[model samples]
Target: MARPLRFRRSPERWTASRVHDQLFTDLDDNLGATAVDPTFRPAGEWETRRFEMDNDDVALFIWDDDAAYWMGNTETPSALWRTDKYDWGEVPYQVARWAQRELLADLHEESPWLEPYPHVSWFFLPVFMSKDGRHTTREFFRDHAAGFPDAGRDEGLGFYEEFLSTGVLDEYRDEMSGKLGTSPQFDLVRMSSAMAEFTAAKLLTDAGYQVTPEIEVTTGHSLDFRAAKGNHQPLVEVTRPLPPTQRAADTAVAAVRETAETKTSGQLSEHGGGAVLFVDCSSFHDDQWRAVRGEQPEVRHRPAVVYRVRPNGHAEGYTKGAVPLDLDGAIEWV
Candidate 1:
């Protein structure tokens, strides 16, 4: 059995908030007073103003910057609040900015799923910020700032912080968990000494014929077949529960001989009859792979279309052959 897929949450960082505060102040000091403007300005003037100075406006600006930093210009729109309009204190503003910047930066570097936001990717901040002394001005940089240390390792941590602060993680976890709870189906191909007779029957089915487990043949052994279209030339035999008495010397050759015999017997003839040995080795070693070329076992004896299904809300064809593939090892079918 495979291990369950998990969303590994990690420890948080305490200094992240401090980092946000520092960036906001640095941005404000560099741009002077024009950072609070509701209107847009030239690139040069925008950089000098650091976005017009309203706290609400400052949050919006930093938020926009963060979005731009991570998503480039394609981020989804999120609700923006004008905390700067109230007396929420500089601490709140700094904390919010810090969290947003860190999350965006981390995500941009580490995740493949996230698309670049056309503008900025900040979750809490807005397109503007209001400060005590300066008039609202704009701020823009041609190149983005660098990301955090060991960003690969820190990204999960950063995202978790953002999740807690933004409340996205808790709100989304239940939904994600429900989806994970559902198990996916896959194709199974079993080849062993015991199922050899069964394999012969299955190959007949593959060629558009049907076979029942009770059919008797000339050899006095129960043959697994009822060939249709008058195509009967005994081509392959699938055996399960391979005979366990073999010594170590011929183990490899014995298996090869068994497999080769099935293939040779399964040769399509003018009469359209072939033989395939279906061996059932269910009682054999768990780690063994049933080695057969161009053959796949039915998952619970159902066709791939009937057994495998993709997740809901995903684009069709994203997963074709048994989505969330559950296989012991590579099964070659030529």
Candidate 2:
């Protein structure tokens, strides 16, 4: 006799009603529910319990299926995980697909997550905030007990001690003690350069200077900044069309002067500092090029692409006719 054909059945769903019913089924689950507010969950045994809040902001699990609506201060409905937006009525296939694709992209690139489906579990603890930003409240000491431990944890601590409190993880000293082992394998030099550029721009902003991105200036044309602190303004130009070997210093100077003349007109304060800054953003970092290629081999680094200055002299990466930039070399103000 031939074997009988077999059929597979769909999996059962963990419905919201089921989850809610299970919660009040009794206290020993330790997964007790509490509302976001202090009064929602009791200050004692219920301290660590997580719950959804009602309209009154009272932490209660009174489920109302008829309302069929989501409101502020309420726990997100369990059915939300099923919906497209994680709403009860919609399907979340698209969201699931996106999550999968993201995971795959990283994994295929030999990144950290190699598992097919990654699960993220969040433990929500109520955090209290005061208007002045210096107050905190917790429901129970036992629930927060893990956060505070013994002392003498770190052996050879370095600059990190400046950031975190010392020896707090002493109870878990065995797990905590150790060297960092190795530095990150990424290109630290290029990263440092990029960080420098960002820092420079930030410093300029802190200095209270009115800065502009990039602008093109013609020879003998001067650019003017409206709020030049020292009342001195200069035309700014970028060396897009200028080559290092054949760059004309006179032409560059003339272009800035012309920009200043056209924009500031006869208003230049002739009193203090007034000059142009011309920058070239063509520097090549071997690491960045290699990294990009490793990710996408088809896209070659275009080192020869040159930008041109228009007749209007509008561009980016210039301010007050000076390139006040940081280590990363991106021109900034200050």
Candidate 3:
């Protein structure tokens, strides 16, 4: 019996020569004579292989010292190229199949005669398989825990585990499917933000507050979460701070405030108070923190608090006006 392959971290050293050798070797075994006009060009650090479907060419490129591949025809190429860094230890044969599937799926949109493989969302790929070939949440959790031990105890991981185990995640998946039909790619950024909101909800629930997720307002803006205990009902907006590469400090801060105002405007009418929970993914400077802290008073939305939660789970900030809640003890700083 063949040993079950497990997901592992990428090796520290990945040279072009190693990738070239491994990729071609795997292709020889999987494709045989079916792979047409395959060629390797060392000068450009790329390789190309023609497939039977529409005689389309799929090319692999070395990007930032990582193996990345894209599939398309001679006239137009795929906008997005899938990378091998995400699943470094995955068999090259399987990688080829994935790229082929993606290419065929794209081509099928234009030419109905081109047969496409059964669609599989990128999020739930080969990662969810068990030793017995069964796919289960338990197996996914085990793989996740093994592959990413650092995030094993994270609140996001915990929330996902709970949701998967209790079937809430399936419902959420169905809701998303209803909103947006099936697609080949997954919006990882949006998913991460949702997970962050879920983490905040869990934290509030643990603190004895009844928490609600994704509350839509009459103003067409959505609050990430709402937590209520007794008469202290606070509308909470959870946001993952954008990296400096994506948005400048001034622009990011402005955007944050704008988002807060939209939510505050709607909730202030019904709720006792409002707060903004900024999940600090970006490495924020002292000036940025000061700017965020200073913005509280200017915010016309009174009785509002701003909390900046760090990657390590430590959080700090201030509350303005006469909010009945205590910021220090109410929130778990670490």
Highest lDDT scorer: 3
TM-score of each: 0.21, 0.18, 0.39
Report the C-alpha lDDT of model 2 over 1-334, residue by residue, as the tens digit: 1111111111233335554564323321333334332222221211122343222221222122222211112233443423322221131333223223322332334322213212110001111111110011111111221111111112111112211232222222211211111122322223222222222222233344444432234443333222133554333322221212232323433332343333233322232223332322222123322332233211011111111111121112323222332212222212
What is every candidate's alpha-carbon RMSD to the true fold?
A: 22.9, 21.9, 17.1
Error of 3 at 231 (Å): 5.3
lDDT of 1 by residue, 1-334 (tens): 2111111111222133432354345545544323233222323211211232332223233222222111111111122111122211222334334434533443344332232331222321121111211111111111101011112323422332332343322222322222112222211122112223322332334345434343454544443443443554332323332323433323432543454344334432212333333333322232232331212333221112111101110111111133222211212222
Ranking by TM-score: 3, 1, 2
Model 3 residue 201 CA deviation in Å: 1.1
Clash pairs, candidate 3, are none
Candidate 3 lDDT, 185-265, residue by residue in tens: 343334344345544554465457776556776656666666778887776765555433345434546645655555556
Model 3 alpha-carbon drift over 4 Å, by segment = 1-189, 215-223, 248-255, 258-300, 324-327, 330-334
lDDT of each: 0.27, 0.24, 0.41
Lowest-lDDT window of 10 residues in candidate 1? 308-317
Better of 1 and 3 by TM-score: 3
